[model samples]
Target: MSRRPDPTRRSEQSRQAIVSAAVDLCVEIGYAATTIEAIAARAGVGKQTIYRWWPSKAAVLLEHMTRVRETQIGFPDTGDLRVDLLAQTSAVQGLFASDTGAVWRGLLIAALSDDVAADGVRTLLQAAVVEAKGRLATAQKTGELRADVDLDMVVEIIYGPLYHAWLLTGRPLPEAYMEEVLSSVFDGLRP
Candidate 1:
């Protein structure tokens, strides 16, 4: 008989497919409409398979966010705080402008009522904050930022506008949006 396929690899493939289907469904139909059955059908696996991997649709979407963070989103360090922040923030802006953004939006909405999802989202956000703070501390040491500047407030100041425009007003802006925000942060608003 021919050699058997690796069950571990096959299981991993199925898991990825389920996560991708969940994200796509959320983008197409919103979180309220994305269900285990739809995800199972789209993934070409049994509903049992999806349930075997995730307790709920929100958990599945959280996996997508986790993968995005691990594989794509990471703060870069070039010893230049401005350049690194621009690079990282640009990547986040890109995510908020794509299908991935829809999935993230759905998860945020779901987190409002799901304690598990809320905890998961909080964990993901905290990890990013810690990472950002670490980079900012280095910049502070290098005199890129004032020693008295509050790192926590600085992180909010950098990212707050993007979230407001994207989530609150639901507006679509151009590439220069984050650049302007960074400029305002770096140069201040008063003329």
Candidate 2:
């Protein structure tokens, strides 16, 4: 006689399928068109299965993004602020160009009209910002950055152009894009 299969393991598999289907749908179609029914169909599960775990598609996507952050997107500390900043920004640039980036862009648009999504997006973005500020605060404490400056503005100054170029201008980014931005920020804009 055989024992019963673990229901929790099967549930975890369903959850992963739902998440993967949502990510693919968001990337293939836009977020507005990717509905819970579609995700259920693509995932080979019922809408109730998804709703059991997440209230909406946005929540499903948010879980995937959170996993990526916790497992993959840690800000590094190599004892050099500049090196760490470059590494952090470059990783972001890479994310913004990948499949995960597509889902993230979709989430941003979804957040505009969705109260639930807006809160989740804010949480995800703020977590990243807080991680960045921790590093920046360390730099300030060690005297690498000025004591009289706001780390918030410092983060904006460092990332503003990258977001502008990627999300607005649609310009092509070279592999050394973050390196150039770091050089300009640290070495001054004027030659």
Candidate 3:
């Protein structure tokens, strides 16, 4: 008899499909409109399959964001702190430029309106901030960043404008804007 396929690999594939469906549906129809039934239909999986793995649609979207961070926005440790930071920041900016960014913003807005989504957003942001801090710590260790720089402050400086332009105002996230923001934050303009 033929051996059965690996259950772990099969489960992983199903999970990935669900996440992809959630991201796509959330982007196309806003988070508030994207229901578990729709995601399951889009993913070609049963509702029970999704509910069996995730507690809610928000949880699936949260896991989807985590997957996006892992696969799309991996931090690069180039040994040159400035280049590393620029690359990392640019990755974030690029994410905002992609379809996934639309879904992320939609979920964020929906999260603000709903407590469950808000909790998921909180967990997602906290984890992302921790990752950002870890990368900044590498810069500090390499002596590329000023010893006095507060890592949290640096994170805010880097993320603040991007969030404002992309999330708050819904403006186009141009690469030039990212470069200018990074230069302003890193180099500062003073006569």
lDDT of 1 by residue, 1-191 (tens): 89989999999999999998998899899989999999999999999988887889988999889989998899999998888999999999999998999988888887899987898899889999999999999888888888888889989999999888899998787898999889887854111
For every candidate, C-alpha RMSD to the true structure in Å: 2.2, 2.2, 2.9
Query: Using Cα atoms with residue i matched to residue i, what is each candidate's TM-score against the true structure?
Result: 0.94, 0.95, 0.84
User: In candidate 3, how many Å is residue 90 off?
Assistant: 0.9
Name the better of 1 and 2 by TM-score: 2
Number of the top TM-score candidate: 2
| Candidate 1: worst-modelled 10 consecutive residues by lDDT | 182-191
Candidate closer to the true structure by lDDT (higher is better), 2 or 3: 2
**Tens digit of per-residue lDDT, candidate 3, span 69-125:** 778876677776567777877888888888888778877887867776788788878
Stretches of model 1 off by over 4 angstroms after superposition: 188-191
Q: What C-alpha lDDT do the candidate models reach, one value each?
A: 0.89, 0.89, 0.81
169 in model 1: Cα distance from truth in Å? 0.9
Q: Clashing pairs in model 1?
A: none
